[model samples]
Target: MTAASRGILRVVDSDAAEAERNADARSESQSAKDTAQLVELSKSGDREAFDRLVRVTHRDAYALALRLTGNAEDARDVVQDAYLRAYKGIDRFRGDAQFSTWLYRIVANCSNTHLSRRQRQRHDTLSIHTELIDTRPEHDPALQGDRAELRVRLDEAIRKLPERLRSVVVLRDVYDLPHEAIAAELGISVTAAKVRLHRARRRLREQVLPMPGEVPRP
Candidate 1:
């Protein structure tokens, strides 16, 4: 072979070797290895392994659901439903992403489904948080109490937002997902995600924090 052709072949081989090394490194990471083992076991009908997987991820799932649904009962229901779906779908799971990421997507889908059903049924008219927020004395001196009150108000404000706006806000702001990722997860265009996020923020600010020159409610 000519010297020029030999050099090009060596460079291509070097790139391939580097790529293989990187892939190996990723596959060997402790978390990835453990997740792979758990996934394999779960796929083989090992109920205990699947339970462990759910246990590790349930808190995060519940937190996401709570943000999306704004009601503890609804959030619990969504998480439970998501877990049941996951258990059924585990064998079909592809390892292209972390199990947690896949699970979060399921939770997001379930959250969206629950919100849609609630809106359709008009069953979200009564908010359980109302009494909780109303009875908390605004003058509570404890720092922790003030923070708790603020959280409740913020959550209530989010809960009252329109469903589309609420989903965008919770996924982007509460969950800290980037706009593009949020779009993909929610199955919307990136531009739509940004617009929804902007609207959601505006609504949240108007409701949770008073606008300039507006009197604050007691």
Candidate 2:
């Protein structure tokens, strides 16, 4: 082909690829918007709309719970509780944040309850995680055993944290609650929330960061 003709063909190919990407991005954006509308409808007492919302968001909600609780069983429970709480509190959910964010907050609260009770847990957390990893679809089958150990180690690290510090860290960083909100939740000053979060991070960094192997993180 002539040099100019070849160059023109390359530009056209590039433009076509760019347009395709843009179209795909727009499609994703529109899907997200539709989901948001479904959330609103669910809030307004539409049962089918809420069911569609669950179908769209349940996986993500479970992931959020898994990350927060570090045990699949606990994660499942947390996710279920979160959805129930979300449904009951739907009217209280102002339009300030994304519906997913609201769900995350509920999951986080549920996780905190579980995490705190973990101290008194009857069964071994590590063993539960091991069994869970064995069945998890996301992990490589070969690496599941090793990854479960890592997750246990992480749970150990978090468990080592003081309850006050742990609560703040989980709420602020894990669940992405603001300091002010955390303060309100914990009945502390915002300054106290910030201090506890800082303390929690420092301890986790010093303790968990230097661990020899990769730990399955939340």
Candidate 3:
């Protein structure tokens, strides 16, 4: 290829890339405008518009719930709960953000509540087991107490995590979701998801694990 031909080809490639980016930006802007219009209609008692918005955003919302809950059943329940809450609180959704962003945050918060309730149920079961151990002559009360305390600490650590980090940890460690799936569900790049998981695990270990040469609490 001649130098002049190569220079011309490079200019053409740059123009094409710039045009594609401009197109994407315009598309996103249009989508946001359409969503805002729907939000306005729904707030004014337009059920069909709201339903249309639901159809457009449901897949991403469900994906968010599934990653957090780690169960299809619970994900479905969370999504339902989220939509109901969104419907009732539609008036509270000021146009400060995109409708989808507001909606996804609702899903995340609902999933957090659901997970908390499930955790509490497990804690209650452990309490029952501890009570049973009190009556069993052969059971080691001290060992059981230690186990229960450790679990409580671990749960507290997980609960204390920021929502973004907590979601990654639950999806990656608890649910065994792949990095790509986690990324898709959380609307992040795979690298960002993996980084969040790393940070989350480190925070958890710092809270849950005993330091070297330090004795664990009894």
Candidate 4:
């Protein structure tokens, strides 16, 4: 290209980059402001403010509930009940943890309560088809098929795990809770939480790994 053309192109690219940077910065600033505003409003007992928080967190909570309950209807019920309990107990929130973490404790408890009730009624084994409906589909066909298969195996593996180990694994891996938060939520020491997580991971790995010569490594 000619010198003038090159100079114009450079200016255009610079302007585009600057615009993108400005947009990202503005988005970050707005997000921080919104978070702060919500926390302040929630502290003031604004139901709408708390509702906004729920809207943001509900997807994660629902996913965790689904993984634990292994049924869409039950997971939905758990999430709804958890939200209701959280709303009723919002005044007890001390802000020691992120609001999301506190909300997760409620979701976990709700899921546990639902599971215990189901166990008492002797209706705990979920079908693979039923479990599939509770999970989000993967975009790739091969990956989706693999995930579906894994889900079946994982469901069985999770069910077989000891309750304490299962709870830690679900909170840490499925719900993405940090070790400290998991311990705090479960009322266990952090070392105990880590040990449970370790045992759970080892057991899951052994359950999922293929037999010798059955699968190839990259």
Per lDDT, the best of the predicted structures is 1
- Write one digit per residue (lDDT tens) for candidate 3, span 1-218: 99999999999999999999999999999988888889999999999999989988899889768756656898999999999999999999998766776777777668877877887786423222222112333443234457778777666556556667879887678656668756775678999988999998886665566344433221
TM-score, model 1 to reference: 0.65
lDDT tens readout by residue for model 4, 115-218? 77777887434323232322222232233357778887777667666566788899998778888877876678999999999988886665554333332111
- How accurate locally is residue 90 in candidate 1, as Cα lDDT from 0 to 100? 93
Q: What local distance difference test score does each model get?
A: 0.78, 0.72, 0.74, 0.75
Winning model by TM-score: 1
TM-score for all models, in order of appearance: 0.65, 0.61, 0.58, 0.63
How close to the true structure is residue 64 of candidate 1, measured as C-alpha lDDT?
A: 88
1-218: candidate 2 lDDT, tens digit per residue: 99999999999999999999999999989988998898789878998998898899999899767666656898898888888888888889887887877777677677777766875776443433322222233433333346676666556666656666767787777678778777765567999989989988876654444333434333
Model 4 misplacement above 4 A: 1-32, 126-164, 178-195, 211-218
Which RMSD does model 2 reach against the true structure?
8.2
Off by more than 4 A, model 1? 1-33, 123-149, 178-181, 184-187, 214-218
For each candidate, C-alpha RMSD in Å?
12.9, 8.2, 14.2, 7.3
Runs in model 3 with CA error above 4 Å?
A: 122-165, 168-218
